[model samples]
Target: MRATLDFLLNEWLDVAALTRRPRFADHSSETFASVLDMSERLAATEFAPLNRLVDTQEPHFDGERVNLPRETHEALAKYAESGMLAATQDEDMGGMQLPFVVEMAASAFFYKASIGISSYAVLTTANANLLMVHGTERQKQVFAAPQLSGRWFGTMCLSEPQAGSSLSDIATRAVPDGGGFEDDALGPRYRLSGNKMWISGGDHEITENIVHLVLAKIPGPDGKLVPGTRGISLFIVPKMRVDAEGALTGERNDVTLAGLNHKLGNRGTTNCLLNFGEHGGAIGYRVGAPGEGLRCMFHMMNEARIRIGLGATALGMAGYEASVEYANTRSQGRRVGTSGKDAGAPPIAIVGHADVRRMLLAQKAYGEGALALALYSARLVDEQHTGDSAAAKDAERLLELLTPIAKSWPSEWCLEANSLAIQVHGGYGYTRDFAVEQHWRDNRLNMIHEGTHGVQALDLLGRKVPMEGGAALRLLLARIEDTVEKACTQEALREPATRLAAAVARLEQATQACAACSPPEAALSNAVPYLQGFGHVVLAWLWLDIAVRLDGRTDALARGKQFAMRYFFAHELPKVDAWFSVVASNDPTCLQVSADCF
Candidate 1:
């Protein structure tokens, strides 16, 4: 794992060059390695030991507070002590000011060890990062500071009981306090009343307080709510009320954890269905201007999406490691070759079998490929923040185009990797006897995390593909072509390069076909298929690029990359055609399906 990450960071992406940039000038490759080492040791010592403990004894509500094991709190306290909760922030804020790319690589260790326990810190960091970008100085001091220091945790309340992902229909209402309280110290104080469901890390006992970034609609003068997303606004509704000095007032906010959700996995974090203003309207301080809630919330949502991708990639790597460990040590079969096996010969390790290797190769293709894409996305983030004007503009465009792909590809394909890991373990994988079953169960939430699979599909095809007159799509394809052009120079890589180029051309044709359809919905009706095809093509391009970098390498790691690249092109890349064929043809079978047929 270290070798692979080193190759990706230094060789392929050239992350070391980032140190020359002013923000990271205080750092070096050695510092990045130290961070990675710390993360690995911490995860191994603290988080991994508690993976099963948290799963078996999931958090329970004793009606007074959510009950969690003492070990969970201690483990998180160690995490907070590491100063990693805000690794990418400024030095004045007690952060290392490391590149986001390096920060993400270090974070993968935690997710790999135990995603369930790691989720608490993940959501809190994402929430605090959002506030840093959009919150007022006072708001930042009162709310975001404690979170960054790990003294407080945060949660984002977007989905409600009646409206799931459809934020436009959210009915949460925030009314102004008419008793001379509009000019309250934190911000404009309002009374928020609504029920927020599926709130992860919503309520927990490990921290001094929880900051709820709630979305609610402020009533107009006519006492009627606005009709759509434009009317929504963001608010900082803390669980415990605070004074102007950021001191706890010892008064509980009107927020209630009505019930706890029993999920299949990721059971370590407390998922709550919270009722705001059950007794009276919960006091909320507006974050940004009214009617700008959706826009502001999406900032956090996009960051969360990529983080979700990282979690998926980590979980996939965990499963791969487990299955590979098992296969190399468990002798159950003989090597299958051109000739038959001898009856008197002893059985070899299962790793010698052709089918087991096939499964492992597929897992490698999906898991490592997902990791590459994730790190690439993180690098783009550094580019956007640190690069010069034109470079930053191009990076932003590419980042926008790849966000949904980054989120959805790993979420879908890596879950498949976890499944194949189970298959490699055979029956033992099915039972709780092995951790792969738990890995599969935990990964199941990713597809539905920030958004469902279909939601990401719609975002990819309906919005991202055509946004800014398709400039972002063209930029991404041009980069892929650059990789293709380089690979065509080598005899060994030429075949896969040509294959990837053909896939890119097919995607272009599909995009044109969808754009030419009479009604936009006709093109988007097959959005999921389009998303699948698009993601595969992207992965193919990444693999070919990695192969281009490895043309002269003869080591085992290089050999593994060669095999996985070949396997993906042979077994996985061809499926891109089937996914794109529907889009290119503008197949209306799905759109034309009658409800009566169901």
Candidate 2:
């Protein structure tokens, strides 16, 4: 897998070219290699050994402090000591400032080893990143710095019990804490009273304190809360009171953990139901201008969505690797083409079976393709931040268009890969003896985490596809066409190239049809199907692109990539026809159905 990551980063992506850019001028291949080596070594030694432990021994409330296994603490300590927490931040902020793509590649190892433990760092980094972008200087120094250093952890408190994913329906309230609270150095201060649900890493003794970025609404002139997301605001609420220097004041904030959620997987990370201002209003400092909460919080949410996809990808990779190893060793019955009653013949490994190979190839196609997609998006982040002005703007639009796919596609398909891994394992996959079932369970949360499948689908078809007169989709199509043209010239990849080009043209037509339906809402009702088709088409393009790069090569990795790419183009790409048909016709079968018929 490290070799696979290297192939995608160096040979295919030409990440070395990034060194020529001024922001990455100080780095070279060696620096990136060293960072990846350290991450892999740490993950293999510290995190992998504890994955099952953390899953079996989940966090528990002991009536005083939440209790996690001692090994969990040690693993995190080793992680923080590795300095990966600040790998992508600035030197002045105590960061190494590695290229964002390299950082993402480095994280793949840790995520595969243990995503439950790795989640804390994901939220902490995203939190610090948002504050750096939108917080005042003092606020960054106070709240964001420690989290970056891993001295503290962070969580985004967006969903309330009643509101779930609807920010407009959130009932959390924040009131102005008069008496010069607005003049406080942290920012405009407020008294917040609300309950936030599904707050991952919301409470833990691993860090000295927890920083909760809460979204709440303030009362208007009529003393009534505003009715929509426009009235929402973001606040920094710490578990304990901290002074100007980020030191505890020996006094606690009003924030309290109501309970811990028992989850289906990734139980090592604490998911909390938190009651803010249980006794009175919790003291909070605003992050930006009033009523700009979601606008500001998108900084964290979008990044989280991408990372969540990576997490799901890594889990699928782990399962794929496990199943491959199992198939190579586990002796099974003779092949279907061979004699059915060869009593003297020796049983062959499952890998020798055709159906088993098909399953393994499917896993590789989905899992590795997803890895490529996530890394491609990561490079876009680097391009957005460090490329020339025109390139940066293009990168921005590409990233915006790809974010939902990056989030939802892997979350859905990778879970299918996990399921295939389980099937390859037979009955053992259903039991706790093997990790494939656990991998499926952990990856299952990703489709719903950060955002649900339907949420991302609507966002993709409704907003990202048609944005700016469809400039983003057009830009993406141009890139795909460039790849197709090049791949068509390669003898080994011509069919894949031709198939991918046709798929892209169909996708374009479907996008237009969906956008032009008689009633716009009816088309959007079929958004999830649109998402499935669009995702498969995107993967087809990526696979063909990679195969074109490796067409003439005969090495094991190259052959593997070629085979997987061919498998996807043959077995997976055709399904998009059905999905796109639903989108192109703006099918109202589901939308027009009567609810009572159920």
Candidate 3:
């Protein structure tokens, strides 16, 4: 882990140092700080020490039940009991009402310790968020309250065997029972039947009850699949029914834990195949209006996407830290200039090697840049909810534009950092004796989590960039330009700022070229290039921002910040030119291919 700390020290720590700036002074106060400190301590002491044990042990499930590691359960209990579970929730719901920014920072500690274990907390938090937004009074009283109190856990069930990204293809159905729907004396309920696949924390023995927020189609009178997402409805389906006193009843609900998925990583969290209403109809309470389930679920999906990005960033940091430490201490052959014919020279640290330094620097650039991006997006979430109306609207638009990049870019680049981690350790990195290999394996999963790179690229170029008359993209560009302009006045930052400005101009031109295409599909075909181009511009701008902030600091600690800024500009910033060229290129080669060319 020394390598990981080195990467953080060389890259991410600069950003943390810059947080002392007045612009970032809005972070939470006493109560929030206390909660964050407690969370950090628990993550380091309770969660991190068990990461290797949990990963090797893995979660197990019988046909009827699921069992997690004892350490996993203990860590989860500590996490929930400490009020970290309610960090971002509203005060009315027995929460601390902390901002998303604080929650995100707190999450970094958990994720850095063990992403697989941290996921249980993240999923529950997201579930509570969705419930707070859409759940009815009684539903909130029954589900959200207990979850907030750590009495129950939550999971979101969306994917199915046949339906992956295309929700319209889902076969799950909720048919109306007696009198247009079973009019529950407490509230409206439905008979739900569906098989949900790839559900994290689907069935866990740690909590008394598991609440699943499922997406199922409810037929209408005219009923031709309710015409896409409009037909889908959100349902709160519990593992077991609870009595008036909130105690579990005798038998389980129709929901059954069909099987546990043996995944490549994140083994600590049980990913299960669940069958709702397999024996009998599973009783479910509607979260919101019928046909609005997809909208409601998006609330959770968006939050999860950000969390996935942060997790990916944290994993990359861990890998980089581990690799850097190995490079610094591990001794290898003599330097290139030394003569070794007869005289024996002492072995030098691997970190002194040029190629090793290059890999370490690359890891530092990607990991730190990704962390900054994720945190910035999280701060935007806080602004959207708590700021003034106009500020909130701006924050929302910027967030929509940034979310795909935040989710996809880190997953792509940080995984690269993990690969470099393995390379740094040579043969040792490939072995289980060191954690770097595990970090690589774990980081690999994020590339497909939430959404793939292709999916996010398509979303970026095909939808989000064009939404609301391109207002979001325009706002983002303006913000980047503003940062560039501010950096231009700083002598140390002017050159890099100008370079970033040029990249921004190229991106703008590419956006216009794509917009002007006769058929939009022509433009959409280059979405990947566009995404890559946009990400480069964003990272360069962030690096320039860091450089400008560091320029004003004169403290000894700031020397590291100065070195990182110089290294980023000298080595990393030049790649923006190549990315811009690719973005601006009009290669019709892909579109020109015939159907049977092969």
TM-score of each: 0.99, 0.99, 0.91
True-vs-predicted CA distance for residue 241, candidate 1, Å: 0.9
Tens digit of per-residue lDDT, candidate 1, span 107-222: 99999888988988988888888888888889988999899889999999999989999988999999987787657889889999989999999988999899999999988899
lDDT (C-alpha) at residue 161 in model 3 = 81
| C-alpha local distance difference test of each model | 0.92, 0.91, 0.80
Q: List model 3 lDDT by residue over 13-125, tens digit each.
A: 33343234343443334444565667778889988898898789998866556777788888888888888788767667777666677678778889989988999888898
Clashes of 3: 5
Over 1-598, each residue of candidate 2 has an lDDT whose tens digit, in order, gives: 8999999999888899999988788899999999999999999999999999999999999888899999888899889888898888888988998888899999999999999899988898899889999999999999989988889889999999998988899998999998888888778889999899999999989988888899999999998999989999999999999887778997889988899999999987999999998787999999899999999999999889889989999999999999999999999897665446466678989999889999999999999999999999999999999998999999999999899999999999999999999999999999999999989998999999788999999999999998999999999999999999998788777788888888888898899898789788998999998999999988888888888788679999999999999899889999999999988988889988998999
Which prediction has the highest lDDT against the true structure? Answer: 1
Candidate 3 Cα lDDT to native: 0.80
What lDDT score is found at residue 449 in candidate 2?
78
Model 2: pairs clashing at backbone N, Cα or C within 3 Å:
none
In model 2, the runs with Cα more than 4 Å from the true position are 338-341
Off by over 4 Å in 1: 179-182, 337-339
